[model samples]
Target: MRTKGMQRSIEDFSRALEQGYAAVYRRNFVSVTYEYMGGYIEEITGYAPEELTPEMWDSLVLHVEQKGELSGLSKEECFRMNRSGQVDRWQADMQIRTRSGQTRWVSDMSTVLRDESGDCFGTLGVLQDITERKDAEKKMADLAETLCLRNREIEADLALAREVQHALVSGQLKQFPLDVMNEKVRANFSHRYIPASTLAGDFFEILPLSEHEVGIFFCDVIGHGVRAALLTTFLRGLIEELVPQGDDPGALLGKINRSLKEVFGQSDSLLFATACYLVLDVSTGMIQFSNAGHPAPLCLQPANQVVAKLESPDQTPEPALGIVEGYAYTTQKYCLTAGEALLLYTDGVFEAYDANNEIYGEERLMAFIKQHLDLASELLMDELLHDVRCFSTSEDFEDDVCLLAVVPTAVA
Candidate 1:
């Protein structure tokens, strides 16, 4: 006679049989028997329900293809668990090769069906296909690994570019941390250079044009980063070559424009650069400078206690170099009396934005210079950069910034 509890358990199993949420299997531990395999079994194992038994499970253990695969589970541990007294349930994720030669992943869950004395009897289990989820996880892991490797390569390349950029332009007298002076010219120079990114497009040089003459040149390529910096390298060599040989600043800039146009003519992309070139003859106190669509440099007259800006000629500001092939550039001259300083910089100086989006325009720059006239040339340059950085709301700059100062040492 069956008790009420046994009847209820049978009823529950009958309900499960009707629902059939996943493929189901049955086994008897003592007899080593497997039976009552549900209809959905063939979708998983590629075999009809009647063909699966304890022997098939045992045969799968010796299958040779599983080595080096990222499959989980040990057949020995599973067999031991089934025989243990304390274990009542089994849940695992497993991989298997189907009879038709395809591989699939499955999640298995089972409950023990014991006898009246609580001795091992058999198991009832359901398995669901999990191959899609597992495959997605694997592809995600591979993509993440590839992205990591690419980022490392980029960082290494930028590091090399930064070092090369420094080496290319450091020979000039204008880089930060060093005071460059010429006794014959009776002038001192100091500068600041900040790249908005890991690489920069801004470059400058102070080359000796002759025994009594020196040229201070600053160039800014149209954009920033590796491409712009590369052009600067080309400009660096060409300017170094041409500035010393020629005394005419405008004519030299014209030569640079032609060369750059020729180099970029065949390509679809547009490339050009703007430069401020100044040739100072210290012995004669004569300064000849050319502006190629660049901001006009400011003059600090300490003797009069006033600020003066080097105004562009009455004509429209000259187009940036490399934009107009036949554009005739004009060189302007100024006499630097004792006790005066000239300031040269890129547009980034005035274009800096504050929290309110107001630019630190020409007016503010002039004011900053006027307020700090007592500062030495180097200190003056530092103060300007500090002001710009502090005024901006963001910690990083949006564009490359370069500042160059040329002051007569005997300025009254």
Candidate 2:
């Protein structure tokens, strides 16, 4: 009486579950017969309990198999494994066609029933509808695939942009030798450019203006990546248009400032850049340079074993480009003796932080140059970059780093 009462209670609980059914099968590993079927069976299959025979169930599964929706171990294989005592339970998701000719997904879970002698007799099982869950998973998979393709396309475009920017900057080492004022002079140029990303805000150009004069321009835009890279290109166009004024550093920067101010005024965005331009005349070893809120260039004198910052006589600070509409920039004169070098760089060089969050400031850079005064322009640039990387916590810079070194030697 107690066992019968527990069985009745179990069936009552199973009937309370939605879209689910319970079944008891009697089989001998060759044929299957149902001893009990209840709880939403008709609602799930659209067939009365007596109408759902073994033949009818096989027909519905065959229809799903023809559509290539049935997957995993077949029912026959599961029965074989159970009869041999290799498996006590099995679960799989499968598709079936309802009486209304609509396909639905179901989760079939079964546990083997053992006879008195430990041989398999039948299975106690449950079937649950899972069509909505399967549909949601498919949609998520499709969205992931689409996003992966778009990310690849964006990476390819950024690579192309990096190549173009590298070509524009001419970051490679270059040398120019000339004869001026009855003296033989050699100008050796070397630089290191490291971008924080595929695109950079730092830019430099070496312009050979005359037989005796060479103009060097370096600038740091306000930010990094695509937006900053675009601004560099715009500045390049402006520089080309003003090449005639390159001989006068003050006049050249003043024109570029006005042009940038005019363009920025037409937009709602606030944008500006820091720049320095210098014209080196090998004939007299004189450099006329103008600054627009940029770090002053350093002069390295190997003969005197000294390193000093170059500054104008008045020592007044000028606003960055585009900051003041009618600001008049002025030129500062500095004489470079034989075996002297000039180091021009963006603020990134001195702004890098160490593990303690301390900046690698201008004083440290000047000290390092004074110690390595005997090294050539190319070797010095390489060593400087190595030292800065070593000082950083991650051994990498967070911003774009650009360094340009020019050494003029009077040849015998």
Candidate 3:
């Protein structure tokens, strides 16, 4: 028969078992017998608690056995918990064989127990099936690794494209004859090339249209990236071949439109471009020009402080080159006055916007041109770029800006 106090303790212990606590072992004070072994710890090992005697537990403690045996604990780990009455978070790496022989990884954490007098008793642990968690973590790690590799590959491809653009620009300007322009032509030409993504949408050339008439063209392709770049390249090759025919500005534009329409076909996917072509007569200082849906070039004369737009006839501005087949064009001329400067540019220069979404429009651009009318061309381009950047207040530009300027040596 159990005493009232002993029976109460047993009942309390049994309740603790339901609340995740278990009686691992008991030590008898009277018989000097340390009867260490009890509770649901055997539930984890598939063995009855009484089957593991104190001597058997001791023997299991001395040898490192398989996790499937002896409640899935090694001797050294269990002994440490027994002596210290302090349980460490431990994991048993083992494959559990199910009824169908399926093996999986599982882990559990446990804590040691003690008697009322602080004597080492046994341990109480919580086991959780963690096969799913481990597998998920491994899958996530592999996915992250794959993403890193893809990002590196994308960066490398962009870097190669950037190098190619740099090489294209390295000797491009040097090909132009700067010596023919007057020394008094205080003007500058500076350009920025940024792909809408990985290729430029704008292309400019100052090449010989003929021996007496040198041609200069600035064109903006329909969109951006590899497609736009290829189209611009095609236009460049066409300009090199077609300019030698000595066609006037209007005829040159028509030829280009016909060529593009023929090459790309008149389909909706046909590439389009806005272009301004000028054929300069070095002998008479006359510039034959045409604008194919391009921005009007500005003529700035510091002598009179006059800024004028070379006006075009009020016809509905046609779509850029290559948009429509058989589209006719016309030529205009400007008598180059001594002491006058001309500015040719793409929309990117005046159309840049700020964080507030405000456009640095034509008004601001005219103001800037008037203020720097007397500066050297190169320095002028730099100053304008700096001012535009200040207005934008950011390093990121929405489009590539290009400036080409010409000035006469003598001020009239």
Identify the candidate with maximal lDDT: 2
Put down candidate 3 lDDT per residue, 70-172, tens digits, no spaces: 3566556655654565543333443343323344443434444456787655444433334576578879999999999998997787678667666665545
Candidate 1 per-residue lDDT over residues 219-273, each given as its tens digit: 8898899899788888988986786565888888888888888888666778888
Candidate 3 global CA lDDT score: 0.65
**Per-residue error (Å), model 1, residue 152:** 0.8
Each model's C-alpha lDDT?
0.75, 0.77, 0.65
Per-model TM-score, in order, reads 0.76, 0.81, 0.65
Deviation (Å) of 86 in candidate 2: 2.8
RMSD of each: 6.0, 4.8, 8.3
Clash counts for all predictions? 2, 0, 3
TM-score attained by model 1: 0.76
Candidate 1 residue pairs that clash: 339-411, 339-412
Steric clash pairs (candidate 2): none
> Candidate 2's error at 152, in angstroms?
1.6
lDDT of 1 at 8: 65
Tens-place lDDT digits, model 2, residues 1-412: 1267746764666666543443332333435555455546676678776677656765776322211222355667654575675677756666888999888776666677776788766666666776788678778889988989988988899899999888776743376643435645468787888898889999988877887788888899988998899889989889878877799998899999999988876778778889999998877789999999998889988889998877787677788998989889998898887777899999888788887999988888888888999998878888888888788856667888899988887522
